[model samples]
Target: MTVATDTPLVDTHFHLYTRDMPITSWAWHHPPEDASAEQFLALMDQHGVGYGVVAAASLYGQYNDYVIRCCRKYPRLRGTAFVRPDTDMYTLERMKADGIVGIRLFFRRVPDPPDLNSPEYKLLLRRVRDLDWHVHTLVSSPALPEVIRAVEEAGVKLVIDHFGKPDERLGVDCPGFKALLAAVERGRTWVKLSAGFRMPSREAARSYAQALLRVSGGERLMWGSDWPFAAFESGVTYGQTIADLHDWVPDAATRRLITADTPMRLYFGA
Candidate 1:
């Protein structure tokens, strides 16, 4: 099912990068081809989505030039970037002016990224806070709680990626999952309802969505397709992703809050 709202929908997460773009040596997976901005926008058009946030792919590391260019060229889109802890404030201000709204921190299966409490990170995160940008993170399990605490304590808004990337067997009881819920109940945390296709079980989507709705009551939640589907590209389709969301939430009005109101306000300043 496609998004049903006539109110222009907001895709809160997705990536746009060409195969020729520079990638980090440690990138877990590399795209075989481009997920160009034009292609992504066309999919949004087909599904009635009007605004989108390009999540900087961990594979591309800090090669944010392409994404920054796309955001500048297309006013309807905004982006997040991956940056070194020592990246300067002037560059960040320029990125923000170019429609880059936040930073993407990927800790999912990453053996070690960086210590947020380090002197370098402390300075970077402070700049993030002062600029009013959220830390869009992909972290799971044991690392999730620590990442959550560090980012929150630093006073930066946090947006959890992929249903908190919870372990299938633990369901909601996972310590990280528990911490995520607690974060929502207590702090400036938002969760994206996306990538259920990557969840261990299809039903996990409905269950996780219920858990978030109970606490957020729909305000701190947003929806995304995780478009191009990343490594799962071959198996999952864009329409199927939206249909999965329809099944998980079912209520059109609440879906509007996720697909329309919350994301539109957060990413687009609408």
Candidate 2:
């Protein structure tokens, strides 16, 4: 069936992994089924989604071979890479040439994030800036202030994953959520409207979305399905993700901007 909004959607967040890849020792959330680019694209195609931005999975650490392979093979896909902070410009340039548009910072699970002010990370962010790439991050709300400051200070575009992952108990009133809105106001950060099912409830997701729409004023915002559902896969479907977007933002015009115009121009330039 066609998407109700009839927009050629762009998914800005999703992952691709295979069991054969070298998983990191500290990996979390091992779904028995692999979420491959082919499978995800098939679902996208079925749902009228024209393009997607494949997020780098932290579960595999710096083993980005599969993501690189998929981006190279499918022009419809762009991706992020997870690499060591000390990785040089040459490798980063190579990754850019392979259709990777950004670097990913997976810090939600890390008790102590890497020092973004340190020499190694500073250089890495600088190199990423030179490529005109963004630093996509999955950081908890409490840790957001430091990360936001460091990334924005580096003059790189920052995309926060899963609606800035605000603390459930605090919701919109939380400092992290407020920090996100402030960053959005500065015009360098974009929040991924994704993974609503991961929220404490549908009402919480709706409240967060409404707050973001108010703060962003309909810019620097895009929608994603968080496809394959990963840790929360058992009861969800891609179609429902689309339906959720409709429910969250009832206006067709606003949805057109979120699901199509913004993301298509941002990722695929279509």
lDDT agreement with native, every candidate: 0.87, 0.87
Off by over 4 Å in 2: 1-3
Summarize candidate 1's per-residue lDDT along 48-108 as a digit string, tens digits. 8889999999888779999999999999999999888888999999999999999988876
* Pairs in clash, predicted candidate 1: none
lDDT of 2 by residue, 93-195 (tens): 9988889999998886654467899999999999989998999998878989999999999999999988898999999999999999999999999888899
**What TM-score goes with each of the models?**
0.95, 0.96
Model 1 residue 192 lDDT? 93
Candidate 2, residue 64: Cα displacement in angstroms equals 0.4
Error of 2 at 220 (Å): 0.7
- The predictions' CA RMSDs to the true structure, in order, are 1.7, 1.8
